[model samples]
Target: MSRFASTLPIASRAIPNYTTSEAGNPFVDGWYADPDTEIYNGLYWVFPTSSYSYDKQLYLDAFSSPDLVHWTKYPNILTTADISWAVKAVWAPAPISRNGKYYLYFGANDIREDGNMEGGIGVAVSDKPEGPYVDAIGSPLIGEYHNGAQPIDQDVFIDDDGQAYIYYGGHSRANVAKLNEDMISIGTFDDGTQFKEITPENYVEGSQMIKRHGIYYFMWSEGTWTGPDYSVSYAMSDSPTGPFNRLAKILQQDSAVAKGSGHHGVIHIPDTDIWYIVYHRRPLSETDGDHRVLAYDRMYFNDDGTIAPVKMLVKDNFADGQMYSWKTYDGQWTVEDERLTVAETAEAKAMLDTDFADLVFEATASIDYGLGDAGLVFRATNLSTSCDEFQGYYAAITSSDRVVLEKINGGKRTTLGEVDNMIELKTEHLIRVTATGYDIKVFVDDLTYSKISVTERSYSHGATGVGARNTAAKFGHVSVQRP
Candidate 1:
């Protein structure tokens, strides 16, 4: 049984634009939150792949949240442009800070083709958590050890003796190597070898090592990240640098709602001794492709050290009165009752405009009308602008089901990218929009509705609100996220 009480009504919200960059490739459709999290300067930092590109070319991006609701994007900390070997993609960064310096372990690839990862593991260091971090030796660390097929997705563990170990790899298999006291170079083992294959089975990758109650645990993501089989499994051992024994599945796809569930990192809350697992899952929109969303669940260990699987639900104990938390949205403006509403007039719009731009719960709204129709709007500079020429700044959902990234430049509307049906906001709905890339993405809700992008004219710079067309409708659930 779990030691912590499960709570509901925790708030959730999407990270704002300018915090994340969209990938031109649809495979890496959006930002993927890191399973592992680190705390520095009293704030929680999450590292995720910024966009999909060739291996060694993808860079690692960071986001910081004080209360895990309203997140602010820190500048790009590690980029391939900074390293000669990392000219392709830099991904899945697991970070640890020691002796006043921070170490970032991540994967890099040299291949650009789809599904082909000619990658290796590398490390970078920085003095500050949010960094312009530099590579320790400007090269791959695994190259100094064994010449395996390709190693990546590195996780670091510091033992009670202060010895550091790195577990990394993907397609071929996962391996472990010890690091010298500097935490940069590989250290020799008793057998005179610097690296060794930890697990004989090829059933894993994305491995994270953690120590709890005198037992060392090895957890990894199984199956392909983009495919339907993605899941999380684990093993255990007595040593920090393990020859671990297989354990049962900690998380997997048990329901239609949560498929392709894997890529996890674990964190123990200080003082409370509570454990939380940070992982990603393919949302319903993934039927089109694997555009993943971040999720968390409270974790518990049995007396024998096995972990219970997580439950899939819209609400949980993490939901606070101030943060917006919702499992899914249907694209119609909705209230707490989950009923859809429309905004045909200003009075109806006023119902959504709140003093803060944060949502505490999740709901959706839809419009039946076709052309010349508007959906929901939030953080708009001005709501009174003519529908065609509206400016001031807002993230609006359109009848097309595509998020419309609208910005007012010189009182004119500019568009970014029509992000297709990345989100299913309606049944046969005209459009839906979600804020991305300092703009909005628009898509039609129908099965045939594709993705569209729209750029914002200016920043509303305040408030959480909604909008609609001159047609008729109903709306409710003004979800608010408070600090």
Candidate 2:
């Protein structure tokens, strides 16, 4: 039997409730990817790819946090407007502060060939960390494919010796080169080689390097970026330009959390061994190609120097006064009074923008006044504003004092289970739902026994949400967990 299997239903253990003070996954809002994290002026900074269609990804934004839990966004820190040669698709910014100047290195135009195409990697300079940076070099610094590697996803690392090096590539290839003191041109090696191929095993793209305890850790992303298999892997060596032997995968997709977790950056705290992995992942709630969000988690290394698998967490307490955590389908959803409230509408839904396969969802729900029902929805996809237009499952408490479990697919609704007259209108009641594989269980105020239980396998993975059909509802103390 699976570890989560049980013969009898029971109350779920308390899941951690996130507050404004607590850090959570996908910490920043909007679609972002290829995050590069750094510390400047004693504050944490994150630069990410504006995840949109290549045509629309013409600008870059940044976020700064005094503490990791709270982040302040600086919009349009750099844009194609500042680089006359950079037309579109500017991304994967690597920012470094040196000699009182902040230098931002980025890739642009998805330059596919070595011809006269004016896109590859370029550098921009700003006096401040967040800035209207101007192009340092009027043209692409490394404009052509070197060592069969596409010149993109550049990462800049300054070693203890103060020598700066850049690692970059795409198309299953990787390369490394030294950055000149100007931070705009490539420096040659003692033997006069300007660029060297350092592609390690299973390497696809997104090169990053860091040194700890005199060991150099070279990491990169593997697998297709658009798929769930996209993940981060690493290899270690004594030399920065290394014949890296593959170690193992470290960060990956969690079906119960998110997918396409890759193209990451590492943050090493000053004067401490602490490290954080900042990356991007696609939420289950969204199906767009550019629907990726920036997230971070603590990274740990075993005594043997191998990295442990990263843990994923997603939570929203509605404390930030921002509705970044949910994508509302229909309704006036607001975060007020420390709860998610939906004003009365014929049929409206707001889905948590995170994906999950098997999860335990719990929340305190209350209805104001209406004959309509309000409750929790799970395993949902293809959501719409119209009534019964999504594919998923929901267990709701009707104002008529009944509990209903139903499945929705292709605008069709199927009743799975129901309990009559078990709840009182306008009163707060705990509503909990668990879905494991094909088995699902719902509990009302009482948890000793499931009010409704059923086994169905129509959908295996999707988003979770709260919905109200013709009623105003308030959901508070909400929690979702993987079991």
Candidate 3:
């Protein structure tokens, strides 16, 4: 059986729909980036820079999830009101809990001069994980640039021997330093040096370090931060302080999904080999440099320990009541009872903001009322308020006993192919459509074979979404994945 077949009931709605573990992309709402993920008190926590104008980024927010599917946001968990030296541009918070106290390490001010106020890498402490953290010290920890690296984008890694190390830097330079037991001061290395430059090949910024199987995996971001080529690369070494060699990039922008996919942190599930890369990417509908949203995807490794390329995809159950990643072209959409429902309208359409191509869009759909079809749309573009203004391909289950594959171009609807399939009214049915190049295939409920297949080449690259024509429809467990 397929992985989804064993997880979801196809014949009846006896249990909840298991779609991507009920987790959606951009798992939390709002614009956030440079996510630092940690397991705190049996829950997953992410501390990210509140993406905004530099002057407006004086605070940081936190999100905690018991499971990857559900999240709770703690707004302004830490702000400049608690720090004396930070005035503006507080960026990239890294959080860790130690000795029963929670510590947050962050960079502020984008400082360049030695006497430029009191901003560099700073530390804050709180009694609880979700904290109104206060500055641990009255000043910045590393005030001066070493090895020509700007002191920003700091990440903490705790070794098995109870030693904590910080990897940070920007301006194309990277460094590693040890943290003292006080957790606020730097410690010297074995060579009596306080800072060691371990810059790897193609290193730009966003330094992250992890240890797996006694091997040190050093990762960093590369390329221009504001451009689509921004991505993550890694290197492996046997020691914490290593003769590091650069390796290939493991996370990058998929034009079919989102752009500028970089500045990431890794999370390793306790007692398991499971790993996830929590990062930020720009939605296709957005253009601002600061218009970034936090997202995550499963990370895999080859047998030889090389990481696999991460695929940008999303699966939404709508259980969290967060829909920041979607754009409603025209609809009164609501999320309740784990369903994305659209009220009755001439044509209701809302597309997930990610750009999809050569992908599979799947959702369990049912019509509440009216005489029309409800299903999935792919390569959808030029959407608007009118029913027939969009250009794309649609695969829908009609009110009658028929499933259809359609092509919509400049408001003109063309029925490419259709089949006589039973579409019971007010009954939940799984609808899936795969479009690869010019080939289109639709699968309804039964996944053994395509119910409707056609060759439509008009629209090749665009967004995937849910749509209803002159009807009220509710969709559940909507998913878009690379085919």
Candidate 4:
């Protein structure tokens, strides 16, 4: 069992000026925590819990980056909508791909006791990395907390020998179990029991394991979750299942920048020795529990194979980002080669899962076919259920070269501002919208076209994406920046 609370956080040596841009630190615009990073198809994908309250944390979003710098949010990849047994408290998802299928191991509805699907660790599967993954098993894989381990914070490690194991627990306890080849359920030992208790001393929660050079690096988060001293420590072992002796801490808080940094996942650069730790931290300015955000920095190894002090990246800049859609509506759309295209000329729209309250979104759009009007969408909500429609503000350019600004609510369209300024249909033009407070400003190319200020906060914070009414449009690049 974990020896936390009574065990003080063992701090690391000071790292000099670990810093990055704010937009890069959080990785996404909203609150996200317990991030697990995986490299697939030459892109880095981060799956994190929607850092909210128990009931509100019903969905999980993913971010993809070509480099480790910029990320595109893919929201609602997995949610309570797909799991029949899970209702809320979806956290710490472990994703692995094998046999042409992507398996997501997650903890939901923190099951204090035990029951059918009342809340425990479960598995979901899909064919793609960015997936609308469905529950692979009909019920919680570990529906009951056996051996005093809490059925939460599951992490999966596939060893070099093709053997996979799941590590998890909470309340200062952890357990490990072998996974069957299907990866949907657990395998049993000759004794015919479930999992074995492997909780190391000082472990609190966030069980993550990584094997490097045949050494098992078993790590866990320690300290009270909501406090400034929340940090991470680890133990090393020669075997996956081990009598791990507690090692020194590699990550903790820097009072000068941020605090409460822990619950991390390690991503060793494909075949290189360069390692990075993907974790969450509380920004120095925010004192709330759900104010956590994801961040990454280099994790080095010492001469003796012990983990060196992690250089945690710190940023104080404002929120800004670039995002693309993972889902689309009745439009023939394709997102490849850094461009988004509405291939068919009919009423269709797509929303990039990155939500916002007040920010600027800019995209270069050009019409390729049909007499169609296409624009950018902002503050979009009710994305998954609304008949492929959403509610938000739309800044559009008509096929007749007219600039238009409107509001969309449940498929009902209302014009807010429109200008007769003509711009070529098939020519690429820069479209930009700045929504600050209640005022909305629309721009074409570089000039201000139409502006409107709304009184109602009905759609205060949602997502941003692209839309077209009756035109096939192609957007070269869409970017959102905080101003």
Candidate 5:
């Protein structure tokens, strides 16, 4: 049985829908959802960004969620025009309190028409937790020094000695720097105060620094955040600034869910002493770098302060009011050997089927069968009069170690895209297929596989069932809906 077997019913509802604005943009891509949330004035605030343009220009928006599931946006917080040099993206704002004032540090980059490092760290200040945060004088606290390049994704940490340090950088490298007493500017040490750099390079970014039991823990997101490689890694430092040692991976690619987890934040529950890591995952339909959703997992620290490996769902404890229901399947179905299977058969049934729109399907194998195939199907429509004419949407793991979305058109099967070493049978896997018009999105486990265009013969209504080709597979908990 999978570790997440009992926790299968917890579902996350969408908080912030896609929005458009002339001045501010809704987060369409990567955004920070810190797990280590700060509670001020009876509200929990989350600082995130909408990286709309390439120069990485973003607005640090504040959201308050009483229950963590439902969130409301704070209209006024940090805006781009507050700082002059922060022209492009303003992201990952980490705030700390010192001397009765709140210090907000973030990552920013100047507009570069060509590919180059125009990124740096910016700081803002406000008297209250929720604020009209204003940039300090001569903003861009840590910029490309003397015609060098800039640093991005700045996180501020204040140690026990009342000293403050900044950690930032992304795109394979991370750097740490010290801050002056005012908590705005960088303070240089002997080597010009470039604290330390993270190593074992593997696309490390989103650095969040925390201190516990005399150990400085550095957590970061590694791998391509939108691709199959996305995950989280960490390191340890004796002092606030390293010579830090790379520890181990806290999260990684789970073939069962097709998830690439990265760009995380840690939250410690004061009452329970429970630690939670908040991160984002690409939806199953995400083939490239486009859409993503936020998720949270309980985290724990080992005896030595190193983080334990993360599981997709927690099995021991259940959240309050959490319930489970099966996702209905959408596709032609079949049953054999006590196993339910969904497959594409040659039949000129419905040209466009949207009836099975919002559904979840559980794909499992009966008795460990090698080279077995099964998954959820959606956005299906017949393309031609002949039974061979079939084209719609479906993401399935072939018996061949490949996870892909099958776009079938008139007997022609086009594998939209595939992520290798990312699919395993025998264990029950959660599959979510979302279809809107001709746009079809498929996600396995919690990771996205692909988003394909099936406008040619898109299905408006169709029936869904399970079947197996060569091996027997079990299908259950099929639920469908429209979100």
Candidate 6:
């Protein structure tokens, strides 16, 4: 081990609530592949190859998130333009922080610059976690084949003793090596072997390792990359350099949705058991191999410390505010051309699918029928207090051209506040509602209608639906976001 390989510090971080169903998804933007996910400086980061051909894949983009929900993209952090010697195919970046600086280890030039055609891995450095990184050394760190293992899909693993090791592969083989403190070149163990072949049966590429509770878990991708057979499997051992026994499969193609799911990395929340599998998948209906998108799903462990199979879900975006976690509670509502339409129903509600803790929900709506009342329903768990009413706070405009904020529970409606002739009936108005704990505020056309301290505590976290009591309404730009 190197001199600095005794104490790799684990950062103490504020635990945001990443337990939502969306946590079991890849939340990054754009097409990307072969993810190496890490948490640095209290943020979650994913380093992925720009999913394209070798020429188009000459750069890597990094994504960061304060919580898993909101992600910001740092585009082209490192590219061939910055690495003077790099020609093509810069893929699979494994990042680690050292001495207050961040280092990104990556594979470039799928074939060596020389006639050998054996590609190599390279190193880049940057001061910040999300970097405009420059090449640390102007050349390949490993430019030749070793023990039949092609130098691609490199992953870095830091041991409990702080030893940094690298694993890489292709062509049904895998390799590992120790890294010197400079972190730009490979080092050898006391035994003097520069490369160790830990290739298990059915191995293809994408190698990664993590030590949990004194157990060494090794993972890799397998099968053909162009077909649905491409997937992730693992092996576990007692040492970082392993005579690893092949374990069970973890991630694979869900034929009904996506395929070619492979080339993965793992992230374990510091000082906690929470783990997430980061990878990419060929999206549905795409036949091109490079047409892949980054993905993630939470991973768990059994009592025996064995990992459970991944429970994956496709990511949902909040741009339309209708995609992913938002669900419709009641009312015959359908989303068409990003507009939410409420069928001329007699009396019902329409809420988002998520159980929001605190949020601002807004939509521009019109009661086109012009014959009845329309409102916004929020903090509602049950759709019906009676056959025709929902149990929650209701804020609306009456056909009589008045604005009222009321609570509907136990088959009774109690108006907390009302303003006569504040709204024009059957006209388009913006409905905005903010809910935080027991305090509720309602707005009509951006005008404040009610500020009430809700007395009922029966429902704390529930759905926010649109209200159409006796009218046909059309809603556009339905939006929800954290306040």
Among the numbered candidates, top lDDT falls to: 3
lDDT digits (tens) for residues 8-127 of candidate 6 = 234543554243225223355567889998878667778988888888788888877655555677888998899887878998999998788899989888873344653478889999
Most accurate candidate by TM-score: 3
Ranking by lDDT: 3, 2, 4, 6, 1, 5
TM-score of 3: 0.93
How much is 79 displaced in model 2, in angstroms?
2.7
How do the residues 1-483 of candidate 5 rate in per-residue lDDT, one tens digit apiece? 112122121223222221111011111124333323454544445665553444544466666554443355555478777877666667667877777787677777642324365446777888977678898755567666322223665677778887788777765666777788988766887776455555434536778887777778887777775678878877777877676667788887544332667777665544444566666665443465534545566577777667889765311101211211112223454433323443443221211112344333333333135454555555454433343545455566556765566666666767665666455656666655665555556666664554322333345544343334344455544444444
User: Candidate 1: deviation at residue 166, Å?
Assistant: 0.5
Every candidate's lDDT:
0.56, 0.84, 0.85, 0.76, 0.55, 0.73
Q: Could you give me the TM-score of model 4 versus the true structure?
A: 0.62
- Tens-place lDDT per residue, model 2, 359-406, is 888888889887799999888877666646678888899998889998
Note the residue pairs that clash in candidate 2.
Answer: none
lDDT of 6 at 26: 37
TM-score of each: 0.61, 0.80, 0.93, 0.62, 0.57, 0.66
> Which digits, one per residue and each the tens of the lDDT, describe model 3 over residues 1-483?
111222122223232223223557788888899999887765677899999998999999998765666677788888989988899999999998889999999999899856556689999999988898999998999877999888999999889999999999998999999999889999998899999999998999999998888889999999998898999999999998887789899999987778999999887776567788889989877899998998888788889998888876678878776665677767799886888899988787878776777887899999888889898988988876675777888889888778988888877789998889878888999999888888889999998799987887688788888899888999988888888
Model 4 agreement with the true structure over 1-483: per-residue lDDT tens digits: 111111111122112122333233555677889988786666667898889889898998887765554466678999998999888899998898899899898998877854544878999999888898999987889888788888898889889889889999998899999998989879986688669888888989999999888899999999988997789999999999887778988999765335799998877666567778888988755768987888777788888899988754422221232321135766777754445777765577765445567777787788876786888888887776443467888888888868888878875888887777577877888888888888788888865544334444557767677788777787755566555
Instruction: Give Cα distance to truth, residue 296, candidate 3, Å.
Output: 0.4
Stretches of candidate 3 above 4 Å error? 1-22, 113-117
Clashes of each: 81, 0, 0, 1, 45, 8
Residue 483 CA displacement from its true place in model 6, Å: 34
Tell me the spans in candidate 2 whose CA falls farther than 4 Å from its real position.
Answer: 1-26, 188-192, 227-229, 254-259, 268-275, 283-291, 297-300, 345-347, 353-357, 364-373, 396-431, 443-462, 469-471, 476-481
Candidate 1, 438-471: lDDT as tens digits: 5444444442443654554345333334455443
